[model samples]
Target: MVLNYLFRRKPEYRTRKLLCFSKEQMYEVVADIENYSSFLPFCTQSNIVDQNQSELKVKLEIGFPPIKEKYTSLVTMNKPNLILAKSCDGELFEYLETVWKFTSVPQGDPMTCIVDFSIKFKFKSNLYTHVASVFFGKLVKCLETAFINEAVRRYGRSSTCIFEMTSQD
Candidate 1:
């Protein structure tokens, strides 16, 4: 069976997408979180709360234009990648839990992987959700493009690369 979820807090305007990447790229993406956190548009800040073999706690600042607020979350990144965060813990924390699964492509390329992502939560309000969704789409696209560009600039074209996204629509 396939297990997946989508969570939102309507009036509060907080949403998250749990997307998967190939197994080969799994750890690579995780490792880049700290370095790239500041680069995300709405994310004003990200702090490493704790680190060990099993869990990672992070604090972040989410911005909607000139207004900015803080959020904190603890992720249980043990065997499976689990993102458990709350907006209440920081200056403002809301409950959000997202999980990611990595699967290998057995047929051809060594760099290939399949990812399954799931998320569950509540949104503050529908209006906030709608607005953020529209703005975030553009923001995420730009951020992803920037990420790829940064990778190319740092490593050149010859570097091993595999970037893919799966959608259920």
Candidate 2:
């Protein structure tokens, strides 16, 4: 039990935010996996290995100081609504999944959307999991901010009101 507590399994992190961009705008930002390295935190490289109408296989390299890893993921796109990516490399991660959901804000401006983002992951090495757990929350927050900043850069601010949903860990 102590070991389990120390090296947690499949920790999931989630956050939702109301943004000043339309659902289509947000979806485009999230679905463009090949551009992740340009703006995403810790992403060193992003390359699309394969791509079709509804999906993409991408290889990503992420590094933070001494901890660097490269992995491939299968990204499934549901267009203007959902983008889900699952890790394909078992050597680095036992499992890793990221989900993004975009919906129009109810009773809000047509140019606004509610973005729900979640990531679930477990490292193959217990030591890595323990190390990553310490920085997981902050890392996820940074990632969220990166996307928001990118959206603002691309589309400009549609509204001044930005709502943050309570985070779920």
Candidate 3:
């Protein structure tokens, strides 16, 4: 029991934020996986190996100091509502999944939306897992900011409202 406790999988991290962009705008920002390297932190390279209307197979390489790893993920898109990406092939990860949900703010401006984002992942190496667990929250936050920044660059800032709520287990 003690060993199990010591070696438990890391908990998922989730965050909700109000953005100045519409749901469709945010969806386009996330669904553009091939452009991730341009804005996403630690992402050195991103390429779509295969792509269709509803899904894509993406190869991504991320580097963090002494650790640099490449992985392939299957990304599924549900139009302007949801985007899901799961690691399908990788030597670095035991499992990895990210979910992005976007919805129109109730009775709010049509140009505004709420984004719910979550990530759950485990590394194949114990050392990697430990290192990642320590910096997971901050890394996730940076990723979220990167996306928002990209949106601002593409569509221009619509509002100054930057409300966010985050949770990490």
> Each prediction's TM-score against the native?
0.60, 0.91, 0.90
Error of 1 at 99 (Å): 2.9
User: On a 0 to 1 TM-score scale, where does candidate 2 land against the true structure?
Assistant: 0.91
Task: Give each model's whole-structure lDDT.
Answer: 0.50, 0.87, 0.87
Model 3: per-residue Cα lDDT over 67-88, one tens digit each: 7889999999999999999999
Tens-digit per-residue lDDT, 1-169, candidate 2: 9767969756788878887889999999998788998999899999999989998999999987887889999999998999999998787899999999999978888898888999999989898888778788888889988988898889877554578887544
Off by over 4 Å in 1: 1-22, 79-93, 118-127, 133-169
By TM-score, highest first, what's the ranking?
2, 3, 1
- After TM-score superposition, what is the CA distance of residue 123 in candidate 2 from its true location, in Å? 0.7
Model 2 alpha-carbon drift over 4 Å, by segment: 1-4, 158-160, 166-169
lDDT rank, highest first? Answer: 2, 3, 1
